[model samples]
Target chain A: MNLGLDRNTIYPATHMWRRFSYFFFAIFFCFAIAANLLAQDWIKSGTGLGVERIRIAVPEFKAANQDPRNSELLRTFNDTLWNDLTNAGIFEMVSKSFYPLGQIGAPSDVKFDTWGQTPVNAAMLVFGNLGASGNNVVVQGWLEDVKNPNSPPVLAKQYTDNATTQQARVIAHKFADEIIFRLGGGINGIAETQIYYVSTRSGHKEIWAMDYDGANQHPVTTLGTISLSPHVSPDGSRLAFSSFNGSAWEIRMFSFDLNRMVSFPRYGRTNLSPSWAPDGTRLAFSSSRSGTPEIYAVDQSGGNLHRLTNSGTTNVSPTWNRKTGSEIAWVSRHGDLPKIFTMSADGTNVQQLTDQGYAVSPSWSPNGQFLVFSWMRHYGPGAPGSQDIYLMDVTNKQWVQLTHDGGRNDFPCWSPDNRHIVFQSNRSGSLQIWSMLADGSNQKQLTTSGTNSEPDWSWK
Target chain B: MKQSQSRWIALVFALGAILFLGACHKKAAPAPPPPPPPPPTPTATLTANPETIDKGQSTTLTWQTSNATDISIEGVGAVQPNGTQQVTPTESTTYTLTAKGAGGTQTATARVTVNAPPPPPPPPPPSLTEEQLFAQNVKDVYFDYDKSDVRADQQSLVQADAAFLQQHPNMSVTIEGHCDERGSTEYNLALGDNRASAVKNALVAAGVPADRVKTVSFGKEKPFCTESNEACWQQNRRGHFVLNK
Candidate 1:
């Protein structure tokens, strides 16, 4: 019997040695490739495209038809406009310190060379004029494309509001939005928005409101009971939230126009986290009417009731797309741990968004493309858990950690523009409301005094 | 040299025979494992003193177990190896004693039943108002952090509550639920109501009617424990029973 290869099929030992060497070379090649990938920079932006923030210059508006009130009103308006641009997270405004020592308040008044110089180097410009009439103030704003001199102005807007400090500031916010919209290629800015958060400064957990920039902080609900999770309707006509009235957690809708709660006491269940539908005709909230906490869809008038999820575990924090109205994102405790999950409106399809650990407080983006939520991975007793906000792409399970070892971040809600996220983090000593760019940059604390949490942005 | 070669060959043949025998022995099946030792015997004793109770009246159950690491009775939770518990069963229930240890589990049985009481000649004059009488026996039930389950220790209190509610069938109750100041106010609202609902269910199971009790959650708005500590938080997580006028 032949124990070796046939003579015609003789193979060289060198061939076998070569094959062994080839296997080793393949392993080394894989290591080299992996090293290259590991050396690449971590992309903090959730989007793959590394887009640069636009460069814009906002010069102080010239005092047109100067009255004694014009000076202060002009100051208020100009300063507000500047802040709106800065907080947008889409623009890098040329600081007033870097200005060319000129007050250009109109498209024709803008000298391109002054703005084109080393300090400003602006590709876009926002110049405006403000003045006072009898009982109202007039404001005219012009946005210019500094890079393309042949093109017409990017935007031109005018406002006539009562001659009050708030009206002046509001006018500035509008002009700033015009510049942002034109630059952002039609995505509206959140300058004129409001953030409703739970602040304990009033000695009770009350619903409070503040401007997007954290000004005009005032209590919205004076229930003297614990009220939380304020969700504004898309048209800004109603505010939906949950209040604990010593009996049960009931979903309460406060009509802004009526300045009182609309009587819809049909629900007598443990209801919480009431979210408004995009059409403003219905609402989605978690209610325990069926023995266990489940997500339910109800008409705003508490009719057409529908149960959306039956996950059996505690379902909570339901947020709608408010863009297409096709999907709803919420946190559910299925198979033991709480994680983000998405389901159809009619409760047909249920898909878990998170694979492991505790993830909750899911806020669906306006574009219906992403979900921002608080997550603590490997959660257990002594499991070294750090709760942080994470952004996830809905189509794929791809995600980027938005907050790395910040002090216990939770309750992230997306802004109306979808470019920013507001979440509560205890990183700055105490729990406070903080906002950051949707890509996880430009994280700025919004509330400084008292314990603040669960911030919900208003509709544009 | 011829003799030496012959001896070497014989020695080699002899060693080869031993090798052949060893290889043949390898084909035989492996040895079987020894049988496990018999489970240790355990003894459990359970008894109800009165062995009967009225619809909402309380009865005492005493239990004793030997060689047991943990012990519990049917419907009641984990208990001491030798201890007594007061139970108020709405119906005739067979109390099963389960004792577990390293050796094995052993069980015993006791029964408590609802039976009609003998008629008395006369009744004493009313001492307290219906509201005052109900309030005298029924008290608030507390809960653990982030949990809404009624602990076994609170079973007696809940039973007394059911008894009072049953005695005054027309009286109504408001179960105001509350939570500690740790979690989100919105989630805490649900947690607080869960506690209230758990208590209401317990009372209903113990012979009290469901419609007589309504539950509300105040979340962390009305905390019994004001300080931000574990002790205070424990005090705050409660379902306070309030009589409705």
Candidate 2:
């Protein structure tokens, strides 16, 4: 090493050139490392700014056929698809009003440069065409990554169904679901689900079903007496609810396939708040059959009965942990007020989830990480709090109040995808069903004509 | 394109609304200051003819007042203040008269007493029919919202109902449990069931036959008071007794 350094020390010109080359190499290496690091997105968890929804674009599909009915299908499909994408909560949908005057709504017609401009600025695009054929409707859809020119589309799908308004809407929902599945990190979309609730529009309470977007409101039971707390099965074949049969309350199972009351067992005392397990094999409900209110489980056929809780102090509203299927979250009155509690399905390891106040209507999230419940922090004759909805992180017992003191909000149920909550509130003067995102944003009224309550979001 | 069209239409409609309102405002006279509130007037009156009477006989009561939007008696409900009404007292008792209006409220009392007892051989039966008497004997047992257990304060009512059931061995009573319009409807139904069962259990504990009592839960469907206030809700949540025919 000394001998090599002696030659460089004697040659000033060579030494200067070596120094310059070393400096240049060092600067280039730094830039290459920094550029690679800068290309990645920074992930954070400590602030509300962590949420970054993917931006997407959807344009009204072109009418593929000349039939007049084809116009109706196209319009319906477009509106429904827009609503589904907007409500997904994982997408930032671009406004159609921002689209360029030249509408290119097909795979062959797309000009990527126009969409990549300032007004559109879409990362993903959903384009499709719909037509009416005899008694069926046909749709062709393509979802493209506008930035990727090598292989343009990320998803391509086709759906065909009977040529009815309901079927047309369903096709749009399915296509949106497919796009969500492909780009939303495998989270299922809630577009094709239904919401069942109680409506008093007919002068008496009855079970009513509606689309997830509050479309297609129709009564499922015309029992003429009071019916409440409707829970649809996992497969969407039957609905279980409690109806006043001019006597006491009974669990009545109504078949959607038959559109009539199917035979279920008539238990003694009263049965209420029917909740379905993640699997459709059994149901968990509250019953006074044991001379006091307790949580009970029964098969879907109303056989093989077993009691889950014997708290003897109004144990009620038993909702299962849909993910584990081993634990149940319910309301139990162990102290001065009713509180939310979680217990093993066999009533073995009962643990109180709430420490104080009047809490009821505990609904486990689909992900099994949190629970949504109605709580009155200082509940009493002259308490200082109003009933509202709250979300609790089960692991840490950290709770976030969803609704303020607007009105008495209760009976909150989670949507299938765990992105939304449907509840009842008296905020609009009378009891009405309302919906909101899981974070308590985007509140919307679902029922206007009649008093609605006890909303149960459907399983997929 | 459709969204833009709607937005343009909305903008036009908003402008039209503003201009129409401006025109109306221009043509209209300045609104006069609100008229002074009407002077409040006090109301007070009371009279009873033949206050003393035999047991089981009724007395005529009349009163007049200057200003009253509503009037009521202690037992009898809403009545005209200047009108005469009849009241039947089973024994010596006092009747409270109240008159209410925007001004305020005034109350008065009158006494009615039985002059003498029957001639020792036979007692005077009440003027009320047996069915009506039984209806009065049946009292509603109250409960807390979503509670099926009998409260400490409401135990006396359940005991009295049990005694009434025992007095008429051949009678069957239906215990209807009701709830306030709060909480989930299905949960309330179960709570109502528990409430009725609790009342029935109380009666059975008090030596009343279990077979003579039947239970039903109306949940929140049948409410005694439709008002959405705390007092009304308290009245709505109860274990009511009805005699089955």
Candidate 3:
């Protein structure tokens, strides 16, 4: 290992004492280089390019005790953990059939050779054990680098909660989020995030919320009025929406922590589509209190009302850039067809991002780079196009259609992680909420049995 | 000698009397014009917090009067000498707050520009009175797909409706804007608002009152026809008029 050095120049004119010292220095330098190589975070750097994907395997956790409840809890945990990892979008999941036989509950039972070989070929492996300890279910999970036997495990986590199926799922989500944060390059996993949307299942259009994976579907607002546009605050404490207050449309606020409607001032007239600023201190909504529907910004307490658009057109559906809160994208009806526009938060430097189409429901991406909206490019009667969701680069106005021929897909909202999008579609015979990858893959239906629309993913 | 001295004295006395009268005349000429005693002039001010408002919306009219005993707002009648009142003016009006005092009469005006509601459409053939006539004359104004502006072809319909509304001055109609099942719920609600407002404004321009022509947007929630077709959708996108008794 010459290391590009001149060996003759170093060996000549050196006594035995100097030669020994030079050898020792060289050995120390080699060890330093090796240590640096081990310390490098390849996953974090590679994830930015989105080019590399780690092949990982997650085996079902073994039940430490034979209690009847253990199997049920373990079943829930295994299912939740697998679903969370599959939705992570950064790993190539190895099939369980290819995993080596026998339950590996402890570190001594793991055989790195079997997992790193062909067929399994998993660079990383996740295994865990679940056991009941007197009214609590405890889970111990590990992520081992199967390819590098000498390297330490990527993550080792322990979580304990009530001995219930729900708690099992909770523990699984926590463990999977830890794995995602370590291997998916430091971005917090959205598995624990909730999505707030409107559902008519309860006999009225009220605000309903569900887990990010569509579990525990429940209603948040029992206002019993027609509520549209549920926008969660950045802090996940309050929800602002437009509801018919008997006489006219008014923007209303609901506190999730309080489980009731909070006092938000009535701006009067037809107010709709309340979108919170990223800081959660203010909100921008459309109000006809000014004669025509125009965008207005107000504090979270419904004060300091500032008019953002005065075009005298029907401006609605305003969404803020969640990362910067500097730009707001909204649907404006200034021209023949409704188009999407972006402007500074103070309502200066107006720029139109859509040329032709009935574009509406513009939601800014969490990273502030793209906007997802619903567009009908070929509008008018007899036009042969369907309303579909699209993702656009806000800087260049370039766009990609996310949903194709999906029956009246609209109201596309980006998840907080910027990795998934939840939107409403009528393709399933009725209006329901659906979610997909940000790049338009892995489309899944999240709601059924009722007409649901206008999903807003919570900001974690 | 006694007679000459007496004559000189008399002449001096006459001259002194003339001087005294001349001085009195000059003083009277320079005196300030007097009409009894000066009285304090009444001061009054009136203002509307929101000077402009929608037809059904309300605004606060704050007023202050000084040196006033009798004060009254023309439309509001007698109010407090200094206070605020919420007024929902159906039409644009200038409220005059007249403050009367012992000194004089003072009037302060606060102009509240209320957005006038749409007027009635053009008259149709003779019909029965009241609800029946309203139903027969006030036609639904249809719109183009995804368009809120009153279409060119639909101009005559709005005109006729406005004329009818103008004839029935006592009648008020609620215009419900409906959209076809095409756009998002929120956007359609806004589109429906535009459609209803467009019709209402047209009627107002055609001589109808805005307060009489209230507007509500149903968005795509309530469809006239549930079929998913062009004909049904065309029927669905309309500014429907309902006679409010």
Candidate 4:
């Protein structure tokens, strides 16, 4: 029997290397399946469907050398990783006081009984070590099931970058994402994502960007004019916003590829609130080119203009359901006050989604399952309620308030994972960008110095 | 008797000479030359630099005076005795400079030619385009809170605006809808649009062409007043007119 084998010409080293790689791949595949199964069961429990939130203990990373940069970089890395996991909404972190009083850095140093037993009582254990050698920083991290210590670690990773504080935070985010993927029901984490928002820190409302956790806040536009409603493109290469170009408010685009403003055709009227389709080939905005502020759509290159709403009343703020890219949600004032409405992308099958009060800034979830918008349920001169962000199920029309009495919260955008939301609120005396889990827990203020509003989270 | 006659002649001759001398003294004394004619009547001459210019351009008006205490130009208020000023007049204008002194006032004039564009030009030196005149004369009609209809008190203003548009038959205008900063950005935009539309409709009903009246909404983004008060808000919520040239 010929099995396409050349046994006589096979080299011993090559044969051994091929066999070793095959075994390695087989083990890797098996471990991946095992880890996925474990995470699936844990997610069910974490969601209150089975048991409870996973108890994870993260000990401070050990320092490998006495370099002066090691302590600072290690602190940044540890803090970032801890905050990422804490904000994940699924973990019950064990406090540092409960940690065993000894160094827990390498896999060989892990004591299963110490972490798995009572008093420490962690279901999962995260440990790592960081060091800086000359200009480079190196880190190694692992996630192990303390409950099943005999099994292999669910995650093991190493990262190397320039010995800088920012890179340290980045490496921490990457490691946290890996752990989240292995234990958060196979969904990718959003720790590394960026958010774009309008900030008044520069004396003008210009587009500003920051890391998901609100670090590295920087301005993206220096237009020195009043710019609002910043919506980043789905591909994360362009930012579309409404800018007052001295005479009129027009839709403007800033290209990240060129690091400057790009040319877009002015629609000859008040054009505002540009939203991108999921495919990044089209945009929907509100324009008064047709004598009324109606919802309009245009191509990415500013061609193929089409009108979507003919309601002679006030129709504006068109947002696309990014998952399907077939439906859009907007605000209309056919009656006394504005209400939210949704319609097909081709301008047919219009449906009213909101029945009462003032609803505006409807941002659809990435899954196409819910719309998160700012609403004043009892709106009037002396109404009892304030404007707050609310999330609603598209299929059932049921809703839940995500912000309560926290001043006025508006312009909520969903993260790519659909587990987090970034919004603007005036709870801290000024409008600032904030982030929270989908259930409204872990609300963290992302911007504090400037009046920031209209956050848009990046797609990736 | 000859001596007596010669003496008599000499006496006559002396008397005539004395009379002649008196006349010469009265004429040749010069009467102080009439006190130099009172500071030369305070003369002043005004001249324009680059006397002819296109409309919207500026020119220097220079003046010179011999002796004056108070100097002023018409429509320009007070000025120095002899100085130059850069003036930008929307239309062709003749500037008159007056100099007042103890001696009676004196006046001089300079013409600044604001030339109109050529080819079928309107036949007036102090002419402004229909659009420019409309911007200066048209009135903005106001609205109530969350209401788009032209208010009863604002009807006269709307009529006035319509009357201006009617007089300028060749002009086109854009009415901007604005709102106070008391509502959401999107809703205010719609509200502003309604306000603009209501004013446009009122103008059209008053006999202005609908095609010549365009509308746009600035929402609450551009406020006529920035203070947080009722008076400011009332000023903000109106149909502002812009010339479409």
Return the interface RMSD of the candidates, in order shown, one decimal each.
2.5, 2.3, 1.3, 2.0
Q: Report the Cα lDDT for residue A131, model 4.
A: 95
RMSD of 3: 27.3
Point out where model 3 deviates above 4 Å: A1-52, B1-129
* Model 1 lDDT per residue over B177-207, tens place: 7888755555566666678888999989998
Model 2 earns a TM-score of 0.73
After superposing candidate 4 on the true structure, give the runs of residues whose Cα lies further than 4 Å from its correct spot: A1-50, B1-137, B168-174, B209-216, B227-231, B242-245
Give DockQ: model 4. Answer: 0.32
List the candidates ranked by DockQ, beginning with the highest.
3, 4, 2, 1
lDDT leader: 3
Q: Write the per-residue lDDT of candidate 1 for residues A296-337, one digit (tens) a residue.
A: 999888888989987655677888876778788887765555
DockQ category of candidate 2? acceptable
Tens-digit per-residue lDDT, A1-460, candidate 2: 1111223222235533343233222211111222222112112111111123556789888888787898778888999999888887666788888887765557888887787667887877889888888988889999888776457478888888999888989999999899876665455678988999999999988899999889999988898988888999988999999887766678899998998899999887777888888888899998887677788989999999899887776777889997778889998776646789999888899888889788989899876767899988777767764788987767556666777638889999999877789999999998899998776767889889888988999988
TM-score of chain A of 2: 0.86
Which of the predicted structures, 1 or 2, would earn the higher DockQ when compared with the native? Answer: 2
- Worst 10 contiguous positions by lDDT, candidate 1 chain B: B1-10
lDDT against the true structure, each candidate: 0.76, 0.77, 0.81, 0.80
TM-score, one value per model: 0.69, 0.73, 0.74, 0.73
| CA displacement after TM-score superposition, residue A441 of candidate 1 (Å) | 2.4
Select the stronger candidate by TM-score from 1 and 2.
2
lDDT of 1 at A54: 60
Ranking by lDDT: 3, 4, 2, 1
